[model samples]
Target: MKDKIQSFFHLEEHGTNIQTEIIAGITTFVTIAYILVVNPSILGDGGMDPGAVFTATAVTAAFGTCLMALSTNYPFILAPGMGLNAFMIYTVVLSMGYTWEVALAAFFVEGLIFLVIALTNIREVVLDAIPLSLKFAITAGIGLFITLIGLKNAGIVVDSPSTLITIFPFHSSMQDGSFATGGISALLGLVGIVITALLMIHNVKGNILLGILITWALGLVCQLAGVYVPDPAAGYGSLIPDFSRGLSVPSMALTFMKMDFSQVFSVGFATVVIAYLFTNISETFGALVGSASKAGVLQEDGKFPRFKNALVAQSVGVLTAAVTGTSATTSVVECAAGIAAGGKTGLTSLVTGIMFLISLLLSPIFLAIPSFATAPALVIVGFLMISSLLAIDFSDMSEAMPAFICLFTIPFTYSIVEGMALGFISYVVINTLGGTERRKKVSVAMYVIALLFVAKYFFV
Candidate 1:
């Protein structure tokens, strides 16, 4: 009976035992944990403290995810996500100059919008209305962005003269004063991915998880050895970027809210939200499928999920994140890693939850985990994501164009929402005016999707 349940999500086949699942879970946790530190850094520059924001994200991740794990039979985790956080900082703070409080207000407002749309089942309609190619393109675009982030963080690429970025920065040596001996992110990310790929080719068990662990350890060693990484300046305290700033309920809610949300749309809020929705959906899909696959609990057809139940848990998660004082509606990618790690029940999430709850008391300890250490994992993960591009149907314009647009726009534009919006609009326009297609009855709803896309581009 237990095996059957696990198999329902396709977990037993992949995730295997408790030990393997735990490792995967931890790896996933490590991959995204830096947000606790980095988010505060990004948001704090706008006047929020470094420590408080990080703590808020960490606490929400631990507590919100625990709620998710406890509430559902499915395996998933909750955390403030890449796109949303970036949106809040870049589009909201930098582009709009909103305080953390005003930002938090917008976040909560967005959560409300999300809840309404999701409950209305508009999620399915919009997803369906989005051209499949566009989805692929958006997915690919995010993959490129993730890859670029990894590469940049690894010091593989640096500020160049001609282009926005360059493959090599220093003439003969790295920025940190080392020759070939440094550049651990590049070395580990490239080498680790190759090794993992080979192991995968050989059908080795837990190759992905193994490769991540090995690279993580190696990166840490390099950090300690005074390799290519630069030491902090005279008064540098927390090196990895802290989440403590701007995370208090009052700070995030009041500070972020002071900014006019009217400006959110002006600063590409629509674009940001649209892109964020795509990434969030992607993470959720992957986590759901991967967990089920690893546990051997996935349905055979791979159709619908436990939508209503899952949404209930997810809704609570978004709300909790705002209350805790951070970004909104960030569904974690690591939850799938946990599900893969023999997390038969929510016990695995429970463990992670307790760890997070405990972290509030020991925020300083978490602050010490260097982001450079995690950069390798992200780069490797980006490599893994690129594999999805092959799944796109090149022959179908409806599919191919959207896919290509989404793939190209995200990294190039440094904006996920822009890519998604373009893809969505392109899909509708192309299908409606392709002239080569058989005439069929078009729905008023389809036209609505198209018009909204136009609004996103010109009106907003």
Candidate 2:
């Protein structure tokens, strides 16, 4: 049985063993498990039922990761991405005043488009057209964006009327003995970060997961002792999650195949679909390349072997997520944690997928973990991502300028699509102005994409 399993995954060929792959799988699952809580909460805020969203998030993640393992044999996992979910709920549903049904239709349409692109050579062309510097910048930009999200969740940063944003009053609140005004949560976040960092520094396996659990336990103790006070502004009203029932069966009634396609051809709808498509493509590309590079699986020509299979799996995952009533699922950068832990085959993804399925029965316990406890992991992951910036060639202004714009604009504009558009446009214009050789380097597709982005920004 063991030999057959090894031969199936070609574990020996990849210089990995079953034990290491299993540990890597667990590590990957731990790093990304927070999505089981976070995605549901975010989607529920947009008028979907929390229970339904919870079930959908888990099912989609498991289905997507399993497809990745089986089809691509790559140790990558998929989930409803953090930014894409926010875009679905905040931008598409709330701000646009469209019903959740309409937003879901857009997601479904976007997924189909992605599938079409993935099956054609267009996907490969797009991936290859992107400059290496810009790719690194996008990865780093996502890191900063994730870290910023963590800071906001922990209440370490707060809205300011005069300055736009300011630090929370941790010191003043401590002096005045006011625990609710961001002091306690800020302190707790600090403790979580310190503990997680220390564990990671010591090479402890599953440090991210362990840190979150330990911090959650501490929060529970504080709640029981009457010291942990929740603040409404920070998106927490209680440290404890409402237990709907000890165990509940997964439900797909609210969101399954509920898309409303009547408004699909409208300009507003088109813009939403385009945004989702662009974001998913760029984000998945960055994640796959970055994680593969970390795993030492990227080929000498800077291409990923079996890249087409990975793309197809992710596209299928996105399609599944839409039908499951969630946002588009994409490859996650956190899969790098598993690779760093020595995962080299699909077995690792298989284990992670099984864990996600198991989480369906443990939603209540996982949801009980307060947002602040998970904030530390995001911040740490962001720091790890920014390390890629060291590889960029700062001396080349043409490359550096575009990379810098891509890196800073993501966090500044708070939209991944916008950052990528600006970066692509700047890269083409700057390189064209440099010389004939540089102009030749910019592909026609890049020019077309830049123009489309410009049109979207102004007209759409």
Candidate 3:
């Protein structure tokens, strides 16, 4: 059974090993759960009803991932997306006040563009032409930015209307010396217990995810029972998503077409394309490597296009959203949590897809998980994200300063792209002025991306 399942996941990296496959699969799901939630929350930034959008998220996640599984034997999961969601909502929608339909129309168009990129081999050209180190930095840097946003949203960081930014407060409602404080403290204690047990107690393989799951389960149980555990405010309810009646793409499509398409093209194809393409590259690459490693589908040369197919299918997902009446991008990492629970191969994804298809009957199930429960998960993810900074070439102040600036700017500015833009821009300036001979083939790509960031933020 173990060998068969191992073969099914295709976890042969440089070489195949079942034990490694198990570890990779579990870790990938753990990471993916957070990634899934990443896009949804960012998409929620626009003025859409979180409830309705969550429903859309469920549907798109189901359909898109199923298509990927069917189209490819690889295990990369698909869903609404992350960077694009933020680009659309916080940047495009919030900045311009565009209609959801228009924003989605832009998304659909971008998806088509993505398909063009994927089908025409531009995808591999870009990925191959890009330097692995820069890509690594971008991925990790994005991770840091993501963590900061999560922390900021959770009130781990508070903004000062005057001086710019500040940390947690000394006293307030959430800060009161009440049962709430005690409860969170207790929860922290439990988390400590989890860390301790994983590190010190048991010899279990996936202890990290297990700790997170136990916390999630406990948090959910308390919230559902209305048990006012630590944070009463951190409650998650089974709010239903009313998508009854078979499927109604016509109505959804009409609503979608009415959205703004002007900003998409007018915003300069270069900038949008980079954000869209690079976002797809980084996000899908992460998912593919993760799912492939977990699924054991790696070829001898590490060729795994399951991610490409999954991502390519996402262009269709964007179209589906336009017709499905939702503002989401792709599957939430919590979906991966379900995968982590004994899911193997495309079968795990198919089951998840089915569950998503039948989500209307279980919108409550989706709503049952609260942010506070996921808070620790996000916090842990943030830590993981920030840790990637360790790879930055810190020996030189030029490389170190810009990377550090980008790292810090995320939580302070409350934006990932902004941080990335600033980081890339800063990297260019520093490298140019400092005359660092050490670089890669992708530096030009970095410069191209950096220029786009400048235009998007300043000019646009």
Candidate 4:
């Protein structure tokens, strides 16, 4: 069995083994498992059944991840993306005053468009056309973006009206005798970061996974000692899992095949489809390049192996998600945690998919893993990815300028597509104006992509 598994995954060929892949998979799962709780909560706000959305979220993640694993042999995992879901509910449904069903239909159309693009190799062409420096920049940019996510989730960073963003007030008091949830969580998050850093300094195996577990254990301890009190209204609940909801699999009846296509021919629907398609394409492309770069899997020509298969898998995932009562499923940046933990091939992805399926019956336990616990791993992985910046040609202004733009814009704007779009525009324009030699070096696809982005901003 072990030999067959090794041969199937080409484990040895990838310089990895089953054990390392398993650990990497678990680490990836731990970091991303929050989606199981978060996705349903967000969709529920839009009148979708939370129970059904929970089921869809897991099913979509499992199906897309496993399909990608089988087809592409890459470790990148797929899930309903955060920003895409927000746009679906807030922008498409609430703001536009459309039913959730219409939003799903719009996403369905977007998926069809993407599948066509994937099958025709258009998506692959665009990915291949991106400059190598921008690829590295995307990788590093994603690193910072996820790091900011970690810090924000753990309460180490908080919103500020005057400054826009600021550190959480670690010394605030609770007026009504409740715990200072934000402050304590931030303190614990900092402690977790320190613990993870210490583990890294010692060269401990599976340090990222250990950091999450140890941080969670500490939270549990604090809860027991009355140091960290549970206040659901305050957004700092208990660390304990509530098995009162039972371990049965959630029914998907409410959300299954619920798309409403009556509005498909409307002009507003076209805008929504265009928006979804663009976001899905750009975000998925960025994630794929970033993960491949981090995993050292990008070919010498700057194209990733099985690129078409990966896109086809993601597009299929998006279609499935639309029918299953969720938003577009795309490659997640969190998979970088798995790559950082030494995942090199599809075997790692396979394990993550299985874990998502298992969460169907064990949702409470998985949901019990707090955000702060995983925050440290993200922060550390972010640092690991930023190391790619060292390889960029900083002395060349044309390359360095776009790279710098992409690197900062990703985290600042909180949008991967926006960052990549601006970077591509900068890359093409800067090179075209540099000299005749530089203009000759730029690809026709790059020029086309840049122009499309400009048109999107202006007209769309």
Candidate 5:
């Protein structure tokens, strides 16, 4: 069995053993498992059953991850994207007054469009057309973006009206001897970051995975000692796994096969579909670029191997998501956590996919992993990704400026596609105007993409 597994996944060629791959997979799974709980809660506001959304979300994620493994043999994880879900619920359903069913139909049509595009050379060409500097910028940008995500999740950072962002109020809250909910969690997050950093400095194996478990264990101990109080109202709930609800999988009856295509030809629906397509394609491209770069899998031309296969898997995953009654599915940024842990081949993704399947019965245990625990891992991974910036040729402002824009916009705007759009636009405009020689270097694909982005911003 071991030999067959190694042969199929090319584990030896990838310089990863089964044990390492499994550990990487588990780390990725735990890091991203929060989506199971969060997705349902977000979608439920549109009057969809939260329980059904949970099941559908898990199912779509498993399908996408496994398909990615089988097709590309790269350790990329997929799920219902956070931003896409919010767009569907808030912008499409609630704000636009469209029923949740109509929104699903829009996503369904987007999936069909994705399927057609994946069958062609367009997607791969666009990915290859991205300048090498911008590719590195995307990596660093995503790194900073996810790092900010870690900070927000751990409560280490909070919104500020005065400055736009501020550190958690540890000083003032501690003086009163009654720590605020966010303050305590933020404090724990800082400690976790230190502990994880120490583990890394010591060259400890599985340092990230260990950091998460240790942080969660400490939170549990603090709860016992009453230093960390659970404030359910503030989104800080009990650390203990609640098995009172039983382990039976939630039924998907409420949302299964619920798509309504009645508004498919309407103008508003076309806008919705275009928005989904733009975001989905751009986000998938950005994620693939970052993950492949981190895994050392990108070819010299800045394209990854088996590119079409990966897109096919992503498109199929989106179709599965729409059919299962959820939002569009795409490659997630959390796969970097596994690559940081030494995952190189598809086996890692296979393990993550299996875990998502297992979570069907063990939801309580997986869902109980607090965001603060995973925050440390994400923070560390973010640093590793940002190191790509050191490779850029900052001496050339033409390249450096666009790279800088992409790197800054990703974290600040909190959208990978958004960052990529502005970066591409800036890259094309700058390089085209640099000189006649530089204009000759810009590919037709780059020009076309820049025009599309401009049109998207202006018309759409």
Candidate 6:
């Protein structure tokens, strides 16, 4: 069995043993397992059933990660994306006043579009058209975005009435012995960050996973000591739950096969579908390239060797998400956590998928992990991803400016699509004005993309 498994994954060629791969997989799983709870909570705010969304989230993650492992042979995992889910619930359903069923239909149609594009040469063409500097910028931009998300989740950052944003009063309140204002959660997150950073500095193999477990243990201890007060305003203060009640099976009746496609082909809905498609494309490309580069799996040309297979897997995952009544699924940047832990092949993803499957029965345990505990892992992963900025050529103004825009705008605007759009548009405009040769170097597809994005921004 060991030999067969080794041969199947080319584990030896990848310089990884089964044990390392399994550990990497577990590490990756722990870092991303928060999605099981977070996704359901977010979608439930849009009037979907939390129990059904929970089941869908787990099932889609397992299915997508397994397909990515078998088809692309990469360590990346796919799940319902955080930003995309927000767009679905806040923008599509709430603001636009569309039913969740209609949004699912839009997602399904977008998935089909992705499927067709991935199967063709368009995927490679779009990838090739992107400049190397922009790729690195996208990677770094995603890192900053992830870090911002971690800070928000940990309650270390909050809205400021005076300045646009400001630090939470965790420290000030703690100094005054006040725990009512989310200081406890912030303190727990800080401890987790310190523990994880220390373990990483010491070169521990499973530092991330170990840090999460340790933080969770501390939360349990605090609960027993009666210091872990649940803050309803913090959104994730209920980290400890009664385990004696045992597991309750989740209901899938509300969300399973709930897509409504009546308005899919209409002009108005087509715009929404196109928006979803573009966001998914940009996200998948950034995540795959970033994680693969970290894993040392990119070719000399800085492209994934199995790009088409990865896209196919991602598209299938999105399609499955729509069918299961969730938002679109895409490659997660958290896969970098596994790569940083020395995962180099698909076996890591296979293990992660299996763990997600098992999590279906252990939902309560996984769900009880508060965002503050996982926030530390995300901050560390973000730092690892931002390290790729070293590859960008800062000397060239043309490349540096667009790259800088891409990197800074991602976290600032809090939208990956907007960052990528601004970057691509600037790249095309700057190069076009540079010289005829430079303009000629830009691909026709890029010019078209720039125009489409401009239209989407102004007209759509």
- Per-model lDDT: 0.57, 0.82, 0.54, 0.81, 0.82, 0.81
Compute the lDDT of residue 59 as modeled in candidate 1.
70
lDDT of 3 by residue, 1-460 (tens): 8666546545353243544434434444444443333334455546655556666666677787677656664344566654456556654466445556566666666667767776776777667644443445555655655544544544455468986656555355355654343344335334534462554245444443455456556654554565444444543233222346434321223333454566666654345445555656665666566656655556778886455676667667666765555543443333344344434455455544665555445444333344433445445554554555666667867667776766666445545456566777877777776654744322676777777777776666
Candidate 6: TM-score? 0.79
lDDT of 4 at 331: 94
Two-way lDDT contest, 2 vs 6, winner? 2
All models, RMSD in angstroms: 6.1, 3.3, 6.6, 5.3, 5.3, 4.4
Residue pairs with backbone overlap in model 6: none
Q: Give candidate 1's TM-score.
A: 0.73
**Global fold similarity of model 3 (TM-score):** 0.70
Local accuracy of candidate 2 as per-residue lDDT tens digits, 93-212: 766668888988988888888888888988877667778888788778877877777777777787789988787877778787776636777678889999999998998766777887
Residue 315, model 3: Cα distance from true site in angstroms: 3.5
Error of 3 at 460 (Å): 2.2
| Candidate 4, 16-38: lDDT as tens digits | 99999998888888767767765
Residue 224 in candidate 3, Cα distance off native in Å: 9.8
TM-score of every model? 0.73, 0.86, 0.70, 0.72, 0.73, 0.79
Instruction: Kindly list the per-residue Cα lDDT of model 5 for residues 199-272, writing each as its tens digit.
Output: 98996655776787788888888888888899988778888878888998878888888999998877667767
lDDT by residue (tens digit), candidate 6, 1-460: 9999999999999899999999889889877876775677568768999778888999999999999999977899999986677668766786566899999999999999999989998776655777888878876877787778777777778888898778777667778765643676778888999999999899775576677768878887886787887766646456675466588757788999999988775554665686687667867887888798898888897766888899999999999999988889999987887887888899999999999888888767655677777777768867877887999989988889999998898788776566777888999999899889877868897787778767766654
lDDT of 1 by residue, 1-460 (tens): 7565355434455445555545655645644555554455445545666566766777778876777666664556677765566556554465544555656655655566666666777766645554445545655566677667656555566677678787643446555654434344556656765776686678555455455556556655665675645445511223332456533222334332233456454534554444455555555555555655664555778654565555556666666666666776555655654554456555566566666665566565445544443354455556666677887888876668766776787677765665666666666667667665611323465566556657766665
- True-structure Cα RMSD, model 6: 4.4
Residue-level error in angstroms, candidate 5, position 26: 6.4
Best by TM-score: 2
Per-residue error for 192 in candidate 6, Å, reads: 2.0
Error of 5 at 189 (Å): 1.4
